[model samples]
Target: MLLPIALAVVALGACDTGGPQIPEPPGPEQPTTPSQPSTPQQPTTPTPPTTGTTGAAAPPGTIAYARGGAIRLVNADGSSDRALWQVPNASLAATIGGLAWRPDGTELAFSSDHEMATSWYERDIYVVSADGARLRRLTNAPALDALATFPKGTVTVRVQNLTGDAGPYFVYVLGAPAPQQVTIPAASSRALTFTNVADLGNVAQPVVVINGTNRWFGDAVADVQGGRSVDAGSLVVTAFGGIPHYGADVPFWRADGQRVGFIGSPTCNLMQVAATPPAGPSQSRLLDPAVFGATCAVDWGPTAATADQIVYVDERRFVDAGEVQFFRVAESARSAGSPLLTVGRYPRITDVRWLPDGSGFLFARTNDLLDQAVNIHEYVFATKAERQITNFTGSFVRQFSVSPDGQQIAFERVTDLKGPSDLWVVRRDGTGARLLVRDARAPAWNPRLR
Candidate 1:
């Protein structure tokens, strides 16, 4: 159950104003002893809605979302509005975790309930067509399975059982069908080992996997451990977890797979691995530390491009005010090299994603610390501006996604603190706000394949 709004007042204290505050106006002049038996007060006039540069009508190619077991797409610009597809007996039990569109945009990959309970630990990977037709169950596992990426010819999934007694808790790769037990040796079970996988595609050919034993490569078990491997590209560098106490969620490879970036804990300094995998002994060097102050979350820009800028939130003030800060990763390794830019400082930065073109990204910001009313914001990089997309009074925006062309935005508008969440969408400019699907969490936009 979510805490009531009144509780937020006590939790955040009076000093922490979540949103804009309203000032009290001066009281009326002292009246002469209730003159004329207090004449009836006149009703205040209602304020007219202010229209921005974009009018009330939705922009061209606009989409609205609703929630009802599955993601429902509605053509707000037209009359056809209905459920895209139903996941049979899918329940709103567990929250949908993450979503991504295949390069071709014909299919969508997402993480949902792998286990039975509503807890975060129980989740599995599922895929569906763009039009909501042909729902496919990709992974049939009792443990938690998440679809990390579905690159054209192959799909990569991360399966783990933190609570299970079993020893095999790692990520696996599957090439369509046939060989279902394809496991990365670096990520194989070996007591308590930690591994992080990043995709560089075929350009770097072999994917980069950071494991506890040692960083090595090979498609098969023998090639990986025995060192019988071909040079996919240059050996950028090697990054090791710092202290290992804070856990591993740091290192990430750039979209182009040319450079690797990660955060070194204990010191929490931002470091970059410049070597391409499958090369000479891995070499590592520290990058800018100023941009990586107590980093909380980090995401690589889109691949297929050279823009190596990474966005992350500083942990310094995030503990109290939940502010989000953005930094641009430049080539220079100077001390004052990285510049920290402030995107928004209010509420909390929930999720951050980079646009395919590296132009800008969309992020989910919420104010419901105790689960009372959620506000969503769309941050545009080109204009260097942030706009409040959803203004649900007593609900929270669970998860959201942006269209392939970056025109439409879909999200789950969760009402009733203890109830299920529904899917909704609004124009990036805050127009044509409506419900598209119900009982859905993570929504991914399908790319328009040629």
Candidate 2:
């Protein structure tokens, strides 16, 4: 969830005081609230399960959330809570937000406004391994950057020549730009990288033509994390390719993963960019209905079946309801005709997310068009049915995430709108709701189950 609102300053209490580096803040020794357990109403259904847990053991997966100046991870059952990172000096930094999990669920990325020296409001993207061991800052530009998305996985290809004679070998990632020819000396090797992702096609195929001869290697799935190698005996390598710039607010990975859809900065127009290109690259294109305010609430559908679909807030008005539009990707800049559907009309809108299987989507809207108490709702594509998922009498659902199995949802709820938020988890059917953590927001579920 990419909430563009300014980060509210919250004073921190005494943090760990000892070693050269301060330790991450710990999660509540116990769940801030008591547990509420329920049974699975329909265990066989593909929809979210209607059950909740109350176990002392850590649950099946991880849930990452944001507290004042820190990023914390907790279990679905509210156990094994711990912080991954915390701002060293709260006075110079804003709260950590925009939590996005890598497609493989090995790393988590987010944005923070802590580089006050560059600009009091500068925010940059950062990535941290799931274990919180390796952290890397990815961006340093002075901008209101947020919402960094990743594809299913990245691949690095290592090619070597086992042949007696030295010659040129051609390597290509199907559906990407083109093949590049590399000269390899006999018994020597070289590394090639590919953003082999679905955004370009149904799948990414990495192929290598040996020594410019009809003899070849590959047409292989680039699925491994370390990468595939073609050596004199076989090939090997690893590296993080940088993210492509496409004006950064609320960026999301297309169902295919390699391509990204984001709102362009300054103009607020919808834009698309490939995560990483070849040595040379093509320009990213901008799309229509320059978003109504800077909000540009947007999200990509989850599965390959819905790879080209997107749901976003395209219109806003002071005296009338704002429009949420559903669009399909096209080759042209403006795309074509009308939206496939007008997803909804609301006086105020915030976040939008798709179920893991692409059966439907969840969105946040003000109840009764009152624009005060916001709740999360579900929109099923097949039935064209809409149902309210969260009914907080006077509170708002700020940011929320669907579990990897699509059986649960974790969300941020605040009674005062601008007040400190509490994290809550509930069954997909809207039952068995419970507080998972207090004073936390931006709940992001790990993409894979543990």
Candidate 3:
């Protein structure tokens, strides 16, 4: 359960950097009072499962989402479009939220509704193949299941359940026959993790997608948690917990899947605390000294010299108002961060993300929207050059994610901030721009989308 809204945006805190660091200030640990509290009911009959196989091999990169009664997949170039699963009057949008692809690109998982549950938010979990075959329903429930994720280095995928009946909303990582349930109450929200999660996908680089609610929260799922995870062949910590992060939940699975980043105190600073996984009460420490009182936008980068570093936007108050500054730093050496060059005077940066290829990152300055309405830009670190990817008018690109191939980007655009939205994608250089799905909430690129 989430806390009250007013309590969520409060005073700044401290970070534990090993030796003698001050205790973290109590963050705004409030969950908003949901407008609609749902009723609890049992599951009606689930539609019979069906499996579709594609021996033709998925195109170099595939983009998929739950739509019009099925899971839809299309190429990055908008060619070869098809549905992996088709359910009459059922869709993943109701609960699953977005598309989660397996690491090997062999399977994909999402939440879909076959039966009308107590509320529209309640749905079931299903996994299908890259070719649309081996369709298996992973979960059957009477509660809400949203924000499904395939954490790197683990066999199981994590799913969220906003239970009715005042039951504790939990994050469950299912493997084999049973599920390892990690209940994250409104309290102890310092961090969240899944316990007993086994390996279901190829163990490449272990990463966990951390996302949350709030406006400036943006889409920073980046932040590499250093060391200790299932990917490392052992769990240094034990327990799993996290709060319900909404809207811009672009999952950043950093270093070994144990590291998770969170946003705090927007007024005092761009407050962020990196919670190391394995799940315990005291697991989270301030990533570094909370230098940037309101650290607005933050993205994680792997440094050859350092373990994991960050590029973030720090927003501060002036004599009369506020200001935003952009920087890149390794928390170990946080004495005055190395600043990144920007176009205008103090560009307002949000949704900072490293390109999949790691050459640079994509960010947006709402202030820039005045000259050019709603566009995505890339900042190349090697050359310190910024390039605009999307050139449009009057469209606010709310959230976006890059293809695993680093060739294309998917984003949600709307005329007004609260108006209806459509999902659009374009090439890295802004060549192929078109609409892929309409009225979509979260548009995530398949990890296998290369």
Candidate number with greatest lDDT = 2
> Relative to the unseen true structure, what is the C-alpha lDDT of residue 323 in candidate 3, on a scale of 0 to 100?
42
> How good is model 2 by TM-score?
0.57
Name the better of 2 and 3 by TM-score: 2
TM-score of each: 0.45, 0.57, 0.49
Candidate 3 lDDT, 314-403, residue by residue in tens: 554321243455677664554645567534433434356667656778876555324434567777777777666666665566556678
Candidate 3 residue 413 C-alpha distance from true site, Å: 2.0
**What's the best-to-worst order under TM-score?**
2, 3, 1
Q: Which of the two, 2 or 3, has more lDDT?
A: 2
**Segments in model 2 whose C-alpha atoms lie over 4 Å from true places:** 1-59, 88-91, 119-121, 137-251, 256-286, 290-295, 316-333, 340-346
- The per-prediction CA RMSD against the true structure, in angstroms, equals 17.3, 18.9, 16.3
Model 1 residue-pair collision total? 27
lDDT value, residue 178 of candidate 3: 26
Flag clash pairs in model 2.
Answer: 162-232, 229-235, 230-234, 230-235, 231-234, 231-235
Give the candidates in order of lDDT, highest first. Answer: 2, 3, 1
lDDT of 3 at 308: 61
Off by more than 4 A, model 3: 1-59, 64-74, 77-250, 262-289, 302-307, 317-323, 331-333, 342-350, 367-372
